[model samples]
Target: MAATSRDVAREAGVSQATVSRVLTAGTPVSEKTRARVMDAMARIGYVPNRAARTMKTGRTGTIGVVVADLGNPFYPQLLEALSRSLDASDHRMTVWVSDGGKNQAALDAIREGTVDGVIFTTVTEHSHELARALEQRSPLVLVNRTVEGADCDQVSSANRQGAGLIANYLVAHGRTRIAFIGGTPLASTTAQRLGGFSDRLARLGHPLPDELVAHGAYTHESGCRTAAQLLHLNPGINALVCSNDLLAFAALDTAKAAGIRVPEDLWVIGYDDIQQSSWRSLNLTTVRQDVAQLAAEATRLLLARLDDPDRPAIRVELEPTLVVRASSAFAPA
Candidate 1:
């Protein structure tokens, strides 16, 4: 039989109320009492029943994270960081994959009582249903994307600034005929980054040709296809600004297959500075979105709202920095 709270309290020589306060309320119990309770729990192998606790507190103590395309390397890193941060706060994460579609199934998961709150990524223009469903019951935090006319908390990177940095670097290196490999245009991240890049390029007097701008689905295959189209439309394009690392890597692969020398013949840049970007084979220059900070901040925001559902919505945007690497390096003129 599993040990109960009563047994733990008895063994710890403290009242059950004190133990509950120490664990749930985070009330500072004396070190002696805390040690005793911890020792008792260890000896008896006591595990608090989360379901029972939820029934008592009316909170699931779990957060739902909805992301688009788990296959994208950037999201996996962000998810891992978020899970770690939530665990440190004594909360668990339940992940839901939104397969690049604004479907009823995803909205239903948010509407039904599956978790306390939700962190949404990859929201598209068609994500109004999700916005409506989330607004009805639980606190919703938009991660990396936001819907127009939606009232919710948001956590995202400064994509526009990061995109500008990449554009400036490319232009400084005298790469005038630049092209953009944008991801799903509906995604806020993609839209902002592309807008920034285009705006900066136009300001710098090296505007991108309409034919040189290509959109993809944020997948490697889509990146490859988009790169092919961009190359076909503007074969003399000197630089490519991909919206994310995965797409950038695909662009690099496509360039290599087409016998184009990276940096020497074509400068390729990516965003989101994923782990693999620094690998020896793919030293990708990209924009870095502080994943750890984003995750920890988002977790903090969600937990705060979970604790107080009536809290005003907040939007936190972290600045992204440019990381220079071999992928975008220019040779001496």
Candidate 2:
């Protein structure tokens, strides 16, 4: 026979209402009472009926996380952070991987009433799909990306400032004829990074030429292909700034295959500073955005929004710092 809340309360010598309060986190109970109730639950093998609780509270206690590419190491890092933060709040995460914010799966997930809110980790700039999500009246927060005119809460790193830092580092180190490898142009992260890097270079009197700028899909293969083309077809690209660490890793290998000495013959830098960037073989110098902090902030914003749906949309941007490594050492004059 399944143990009910009544059974738990009886075993713990507490009223049914007291058990309800403890389970729902409604009010603070003394530690001793909490321990007694918990022990009773364990001994009786009591499992709260989540469906009944949802019916009462009108909240699923689950948050939907929409990611563009699970393959990108950056998204997984953000997901891990979000999961941990949400878990602390007694909320579980349900992940939905969309194809560049253009898939029916995300809308279906929302419509299914499976989650109380959503966290878009890959919201594209000027995304209609995100607009639809906003219209759906789902309490959602954008993480690491945002639409230009969307009325939604956002948490992200200072992409422009971080990219500018890399540009300055490359230029100050005497690397001329620099090139850029970008990910999805529609992504806010890509736009900000490309804009910042190019704008800063222009201000430094080294405007990037069209030939030196290439686009990729934020994949290693795309990075390898673009890098090979840039090195073989173009001329005198002394430095390459990739949009993310995965691309940078591919560029590193491609550069080596082409017999181009990194940092000595060519400098490379990337964003996100993923784990692979620190591996002994790569040693990639990249921009380090505090993904865990970003996720935590995003979770907080979403919960707050859920509490007060009419709250004004907030945009939180954390500062990003550069992590230097062997891939971007100062070039010799």
Candidate 3:
């Protein structure tokens, strides 16, 4: 028969209850008793039943992460950061992409109490599910996105400030005919970026014309199509500001196909300084959204919510830095 806590207690010469306490680390045990139990377990190769432990503690040690699309390169980087952060605290992550939090998988996980909490990487402004989750006081955190009226802990980069910086840079560089490509209108990220860019440009006495502003899904294909649309509609556009890096890449390719010289003729920049942005072929200048910091802060907020569900919601916004490269500036020496 496999060794049980009883066998461990027998080998350690301690009471079975003492062994249980040591195994669960629940009621503190004396160092000597803990050492003895641990030694015996190592010798007997005893593994505690996780399900039993969860039943007693009421914590499954699992976190749920919801994202709109894992196919986006940025999301994979975000997941890697979240995984590393969670692993450090001895927690596991269960991810739900595609439909994000709107689908049955996430609903089932929450209803079945499989996840201790949820982190939303993508939440639309009109997400009724998010509103319900907030009302239920579920242990939840929003990362990189926020719902309109939902009250929950949130972690994201300073989208408005970053976009403002880009606008200033482009205007100062003598790029007058500027255009903006935005993501979904419902996304807070897209709204903030567009707001900041437009506000800053207007403040500089050069507002973007309505025809110069276009919207697209946050996908490469959408980026290409939108870039073509902007260029086609406004042939005089000398600068293009993309809501995200993927769109910037598409603009780069479409501009090249349209026989436009980058930097020399049309300057381009984007947000979310993803890895591919630094590739020699692309060399995109962008606003850097620190995925690592975002993941760490979101995990910290989720863990805090887990401990105290009644804690007041908090928002953490990290500042973004501008990375200037060949896409928006002259090549460096």
TM per prediction: 0.88, 0.90, 0.94
Kindly give the stretch of ten consecutive residues in candidate 1 with the minimal lDDT sum: 101-110
lDDT of 1 by residue, 1-333 (tens): 877788899988999877676676558788888889989889999898777787787777777887778899888998999899989987778887877553445446545655777777767866656656665755777777766556677788988889999888888889888888988888887888999999999999988778888998888999999998888778898888898999999999999999988888888899999999999799999999999999888888878887787888787889999999998765456
Residue range 230-309, candidate 2, lDDT tens digits: 98876588899998888898899999999999988888899998877898899999999998899899999999998999
User: How many Å off is the CA of 297 in candidate 1?
Assistant: 1.4
| Per-candidate total of colliding backbone pairs | 0, 0, 0
Worst 10 residues of 2 by lDDT: 101-110
Which one is best on lDDT?
3
The residue-by-residue lDDT of candidate 3 on 130-211, one tens digit each, is 7776777778888998765568898888888999999889878778799999889888889989998899999998988888
Between 1 and 2, whose TM-score is larger?
2
Local distance difference test scores for all models: 0.83, 0.86, 0.87
**CA shift of 209, model 1, Å:** 1.8
Each candidate: RMSD: 3.0, 2.8, 2.1
Worst 10 residues of 3 by lDDT: 98-107
Clashing pairs in 1: none
Question: How many Å off is the CA of 177 in candidate 1?
Answer: 0.2
Ranking by lDDT: 3, 2, 1
In candidate 1, position 245 carries an lDDT of: 94
